[model samples]
Target: MRNRLVFSAFSAAAVLAVVWPFLFGGQLAWRDMLVLDYPQMTASNFGGGDLFARNAPQDGFLSIIAVVMPATWVVKALMVASAVGAATGAWWLSNKELLPTLSAIALAVANPFVIERLLQGHWSVVIAAWLLPLIAAAALNGRALLVWLLVFVASLTPTGALVGITVALVCMNKHRLVTLGLGVLYLLPWAIPGIIATFRGGQDMNPLAAAQAFAPRAEEAVGTLGALLGLGGIWNADAVPDSRHLGFALFGLGVFACVLLGIRSVPKRLIVLALVGMGIAIFAWLAPAAMAWALEHIPGAGLFRDSQKLLILALPAYVAAI
Candidate 1:
């Protein structure tokens, strides 16, 4: 009960922190904010086409919500919920895994990757990130496959679906086949369309240029590193919210402590996972040639033109590692 309270309090705090600017009579407008314009929500809009074909199942879910509710409320609710969910999910995972409570919450909710994505107005990515810790816990415990299936369905984005499925399979040691089956069934909605689209010849894109364009900027990469340790901030000067300096400082301290703990106590597998995730993120920055080559030759690599997005896969590992 005490743990639950702590979790709830921190979760609420996390939500408030993210929305502080809005609470002060600010507005939500920037790249991708057009989705929040409620007037655009319509059946024709929602049913314009299959999401699987577009490889954005998550965006489809958001479109449906926009149609059903006022867009402003939907956006506000999602922003708060995503932040709270990420913190709560981390708290729950930490409790289940015997990790540090505060450290987990800090890394989960305020990670640079999450903040960057949020600032970038990538709501679907943020939502998927918030769900990752819970999904990891569920998979590890061999429960909630159905719930996870639903989450994957809503996540819709290839990165979200792939990460969720991969995590579940890796953690579900006792019920591998069952988990795999559920994942397949849940993904069919998107998979069938994606497969059909692939067969029909996908849209033309310069894979190499796309890869380079979306790779994390240097400051973004530094922020990703900081986030791995609970010090979440972005590289873009314009993206940082106002008056977050104290928060960033405290987060850095928390990250430093977590790093010490990780070196002393984290499991080998988790450390390896973190390194692999970091390596993938770095590959896009440090080895553009290799990244471009992989993007060109690898079948599904094209989907992750914004390879920095792969950092989402690392957050859960970082939490678990700490």
Candidate 2:
């Protein structure tokens, strides 16, 4: 109970730390502010139809949700409930370690830069963040059908694809066929339409080119020093995003400490996954040169253009490793 209280308090504090600044419509740093935008300008119509030119799934799942029950209070209640689902999922997956569990709770609460983005209107990302751990728990428990149902529901939203794919890969089940079939089932609705539209030249983008885009080259890779501090350091710092990178480092350190102390032995496979994921995050956050090299040599380096996605991969990597 004491631990739970600590968890709740930290979760609420971290969330408020990220969220309170914007509650009054006050300006956020560029990246936090950008969350207000991003997916809208992405390569696909998966964000939405070509309906408004703003036609992207920025709020895909949320829009459908609002339509079903348009009241603000109702939506907030439902979203909060979903956030609880996400927290529960994290708890189940974390091997019952106090610090790791606390970290996961903190991540879930402040995640995707807190529920602020959702409150501000980017419901798709919020939904995806909320679903991420839940789906991972289902996969870890070998509940293929449950995972499938989640994927299907999440697929109706925008960022869900990313979260679903991350969980699938990290869980790395031997029953790949089950996960694949379920994924295809969930995605087929959007996939079929997207493909048809492409063939008819009505699709939203050039998939080939879209797949090739890299991280914005000009954005400097900030290090962990400023991250240790609450604000971004002097050099071209993007505060929240930079601070998040710090959070990732702390997460990595926590795992390393666990491993070093022989708290328990971890399997080799999970260790490999965690190390690789952490390496990727470090490369992206500390070495601009390495990040560039990756962008050139690796196809999906750009997919995680926003280093924030590293947490998506990192959390499961840690959970599995633990």
- Evaluated with lDDT, which candidate comes out highest? 1
- Once fitted onto the true fold, the runs of candidate 2 whose alpha carbons sit more than 4 angstroms away are 1-63, 71-78, 95-100, 111-123, 156-159, 169-175, 189-308, 319-322
Relative to the unseen true structure, what is the C-alpha lDDT of residue 191 in candidate 2, on a scale of 0 to 100? 52
The best candidate by TM-score is: 1
Question: What Cα-based lDDT does every candidate model obtain?
Answer: 0.60, 0.48
> Against the hidden reference, what TM-scores do the models get?
0.76, 0.57
Error of 2 at 206 (Å): 14
TM-score, structure 2 vs. true: 0.57
The digit string of per-residue lDDT tens for model 1 on 1-322 reads 7766766776677767766654433246666544543454333332234332443454455666667775556656665666766776676566443237776776787776777677877666777777777676665666765446535543555666776777666656677777678677666656666666566666676766776676655333335445433433333445554434434534554665666666544444345555665667766666777778887677667666666666666666677656
lDDT of 2 by residue, 246-309 (tens): 4443543444454345424444444454455445544555565666555445643444544433
Residue pairs clashing in model 2 are 47-56, 47-57, 48-56, 48-57, 110-114
Which residues of candidate 1, in runs, are more than 4 Å off? 1-4, 19-29, 36-55, 63-68, 71-79, 95-100, 146-150, 220-257, 263-269
Q: Candidate 1: lDDT over CA atoms? A: 0.60
